[model samples]
Target: MELNGVVSAWLLSTVKVKKIKMSKQWGQKAEELEISNKVAGLGLGQKGSNQTSDTEDGPDAANPAEASLLMKIIRQGLVESKLDIEIQRKDPNSPLYSVKTFEALHLKPNLLKGVYAMGFNAPSKIQETALPTLLADPPQNMIAQSQSGTGKTAAFVLAMLSRVDATKNYPQVLCLSPTYELAIQTGEVAAKMAKFCSEIKLKFAVRGEEVPKGTKITDQILIGTPGKMLDWGVKFGMFDLSKIKVFVLDEADVMIDRQGHQEQCIRIHKCLPSTCQMMFFSATYHSAVMEFAEIIVPNPIIIRLLREEESLDNIKQYYVKCKSPEDKYRAICNIYGVITIGQAIIFCHTRKTASWLSEKMSKDGHSVAVLSGELTVDQRIAVLDRFRAGLEKVLITTNVLSRGIDVEQVTLVVNFDMPMDLNKKADCETYLHRIGRTGRFGKAGIAINLIDSPQAMEICLDIEAHFGKKIQLLDIEDAEEIEKIGA
Candidate 1:
């Protein structure tokens, strides 16, 4: 799911403030809250305290040999947590990869032809696990969680087409997304997959535009953003809720994250048939988002795969400790002398920071461009195109290109400001996605983190605990003395 911009830290700041207010009213210290009886009620507490002595000798404390073991444990924990929540298992010997074409999936002949034409042989991880469950007798609600580039788009599209009715075509299936880009992306994917099923009619809704005066609406599938879909419903008239058998929300979590758009999603649900099946897909889903999903879906068949190992294996993780924000700026300047890398992405906590950093980098004679939601969609695409074409060696942004968007030339990812919220408790999805931009398709990469405060160190430790990966600290002032003890 692609969000138009980064509001996670902002949203999390609000959540933190509210929590602090509640804690103060109840007169509870952070340590007290951590071990409170109420926390124990959540059934997430360890048998012993989560706290350990700072002097404890272990790999988590920066020793090389033990740190490697710490990473292994953290990786195991990530996989275990996901598996515990879902009932699916990984089959190394599954025939999915060996299968040459999707024809054996029992799809209609027209659909088979379309699949063949798309040049897809065999199925992706998402398609392999999700298809059979979706095609079973008495269809069930499904909740699929997989990273982007895993072909999740095809899995949901196929599910929608398989159940769509072509006889009375007035939009029997509706797929909603968060942004225009992702909505259009999903619509394009649906069109490609449905091309194999010749009988299915697909039409994307128009905004402030009507389905021509005398034209009959014969499309069996409708794909659009919530706002346009809602607008079309008010203009074109609502279809029979009873006949709409399938509903899919691509990038469901992001749709819910945008407060105004979420209302439209709920309204769509209200208009769907009581027996309609719903499926949701996304790479990063938070606790609040998952809670909202449970209320919307019925007995959903949840399938969450093991979190992919942090792509930092090849990337040298480094941190420069600075005394203040200004010190961080100086450190960034010094980095130019230490390493002349190909290209890099500097991430900030807000658009203001991104803009300021880009200006400073440019002043230092480095080619730089800034990306944020404040720019028009065309402007954003233009920046991306330039970066991909090697015209821009450095790009600054506020989590805009953290996920979904892939640019290969970027060999380094710099975190100017530590991400405040990793979102999920057990997995570092946001952190991994940011670094995954580099070191993609099995190439090497570098991730540099500039730490200027104690809170930043805390965030780093939490990320390390979550991913079980050690990010080495670097003293950029003494480049010759820098050590790779753990990372």
Candidate 2:
């Protein structure tokens, strides 16, 4: 039988064991059996008396390293199984909840084909809970929060495709993001998801995209930034709001927190049909954002997957204490030699700092790219494309690339200046989003907060208190110790 069947049988076999003694014995037997099965599955057969010996003989009796590896796998499997059970038990009324297969959700044939073509075999926890609520009759509004790279994009993209009336070419669905890069990324994903539905047209209203004046948007789905989207709707009169069936606000918290984004978003919302279904998604939401959401999306079903403290557990966070600004630079350069980083992002607080760092790094013989608001839209796109394609190894930027830019190979993030607001206080939200650029999809990552002064250290402490995570100290002098930090 397969691993799933084995897990199911193991779960079922212990259901009727009521007594504590019986339950303990069953648990032990189940663990041993599961471990044995996993060992066989890996083609690591129990070969000699030493390998096949009893558990009480301890891992030293066999290979100590192999025993440690097996224990780690077992613990990880138990954690995943527990999470799956908890998710299923939490939302029993959801039709898509606990569904193992996409076909079980009864999605449209085209959507199903798109999903499989995208290589998704099973529904993620967010998809299992949010899809049914999104696809329900009357199309209720929804507010979902999940960690970065948890299939939230796919969930909402599926919803948008499912709700669109492909027969109508007048912008039936609209999705808004905070940045041009993010907007373009979302549009690309939506296009891929709706590939089988060839009749479904998609439009992007991001910066630098030339939408001819007086041209009507005949696409079935529209994705863009709030400013550009509103510009197209109000200035160019490009969108037909009455025909819009679904509206999505990606990165809701960031969108609402910006200077004019809230007002622009409200204007767009006001123009949409009252019957249009609204969906909001983000990695984090403040109480104020939640209050605003209550007003924008009426009677919404909220699916929050992570609390503040529970988030970003997959990313190992640390801080390097430096004696001066020069020491900080030396520490950063030293890090490149110590860690095996696939890609690194260094976050500066200002464009000037980013430019200076970029120049300095390039002078030091590193392939680096600098991104900030100073660059034109086309320039930003080119830099991002090269970085995403792995042509650039280091990206130095301000807050522009902080949120919603998903680069899978970014294994290291350095908070060079430390994210701080105008009052010189720690900006927890930006800090979270900055580190989130790495650690995509539950992959292990490392974030280094370089601190040169007591104030910066205090700011790091505030961030630690905010997220309830410890920022371990790193000894820059000890190369071996730094190497083992993320390993």
Candidate 3:
């Protein structure tokens, strides 16, 4: 009400007075005021003007910066509040976002053709914001802090792919990931996305796994894990990074978190061309990782999505708090009876628990399979393929399948073992990706977090706090409910 009253006062006053009135009206009634309150409700109430002065003063105001700090806080809170500001569609006559890319940067024909073949209609949010800085005259290095599933891959991929020259192919782009699975996954995407390049053949370097028994490193795009790629680059004497146009540290946070791999990443950076464009992409950013990235790409355009929480509209996330693990297991069985479940991925924290749960489920006569890092590539692939093909109803695994793997048929995700981090547990992105296997391509899906422990309760609390949505819990002790779930 105080807010509405202030807005009302502003609307009645002159533009200059409105600004002063707005500043003075904070923490006062605005919604419940005179008939002029209707003016406050209008869409055209000096958007962004209210905090303009605050932003200009920034952190250099009176009190040796304390006033500026206070102003900054006020502005941030106001912006995030989604109050007083009006949102309307852009005028149709107005131009859309600017076009900035390889063509804008004056790249050659081969690179341009590759970009067209990637099936990109235009730039995504990340691409639109970062391309100008990236494609600058001298090509400033980029430290992109964007969320996953928001097309960060395409931004860097296009930059790297656009740098490759079809004529001379000697591994132009080098991408480093944290794990072998992620490396292979990224390589696959690079291969497919770059398949239309025709001239650029991307290669994957897997340790102890020979590439067709006689594959060479003559590919234009080379993606691999740090250890394997570095080892191969050194062994094959093929790392001539001096001529490399792009160096990408994909998932920089994960890459550097390894015991000593951060130093290795620095070493790899040192090998790159002095003028090469370095790009870093990560879903979450830590201070240490950001500092490390500063060494590789100084003064990077920090592109933030600025979303308060992840979006899980396509994913139905719920929590089932049970008295014990057995009760939680029974709840899952009960829910299965009510819904026709497609391929479901059950997330467990440990291999032992995963295997034990699988065994117990098998005794209950569920067509279940288990997956963990212990599984060989072939074993994992077989399990994944079977699950994808709908041969298996549920497969249990750890975080290995968390980030990159996407199976369309997975309609349900059961968090049998709650995630350790609540911030991550209820994360809409991870939640979407987890339950995304089902309700894919506009299909409806469901995710159930089996909260059978104190730890699981904490995860539930975090989910509630993160999404600001309450989960409906079902009591499954009833015989009818138990029978339905078991059936």
**lDDT top scorer:** 2
Q: How many pairs in model 1 have backbone atoms within 3 A of each other, for residues 3 or more apart or on separate chains, i.e. clashes? A: 5
In order, candidate lDDTs are 0.62, 0.71, 0.57
Off by over 4 Å in 1: 1-100, 179-181, 196-199, 211-218, 227-237, 324-326, 421-429, 442-444, 465-468, 482-487
Per residue, candidate 1 scores C-alpha lDDT tens digits across 438-466 of 88666788787888777788777888877
Give the better candidate number (1 or 3) by TM-score: 1
Q: Weakest 10 consecutive residues, lDDT, candidate 3?
A: 1-10
Clashing pairs in 2: none
Name the runs in model 2 displaced over 4 angstroms: 1-98, 114-122, 146-154, 164-245, 257-261, 264-275, 308-323, 333-345, 358-373, 376-395, 403-413, 433-448, 468-487
Better of 2 and 3 by lDDT: 2
Model 1 whole-model lDDT (C-alpha atoms): 0.62
**Better by lDDT, candidate 2 or 1:** 2
Q: Estimate each model's TM-score.
A: 0.70, 0.61, 0.59
- Between candidates 1 and 3, name the one with more favorable lDDT: 1
Candidates, ranked, TM-score: 1, 2, 3
lDDT of 3 by residue, 1-487 (tens): 0000001111111111114366445423332232123322332213221111222112110121121222222222111121121111224352223354446645456555555665555555566666665556566666766544555666677677667777885778888876655665566556545654666767665454343222345677777677666655543445465667778887776565554455456546656667777788875565555656665565455554454333356666667778876777887777776667767788776666677788888898889988665555566667766776778888877644553345667777887766543233444444444554455555666767787777668667876676776665646555564334323
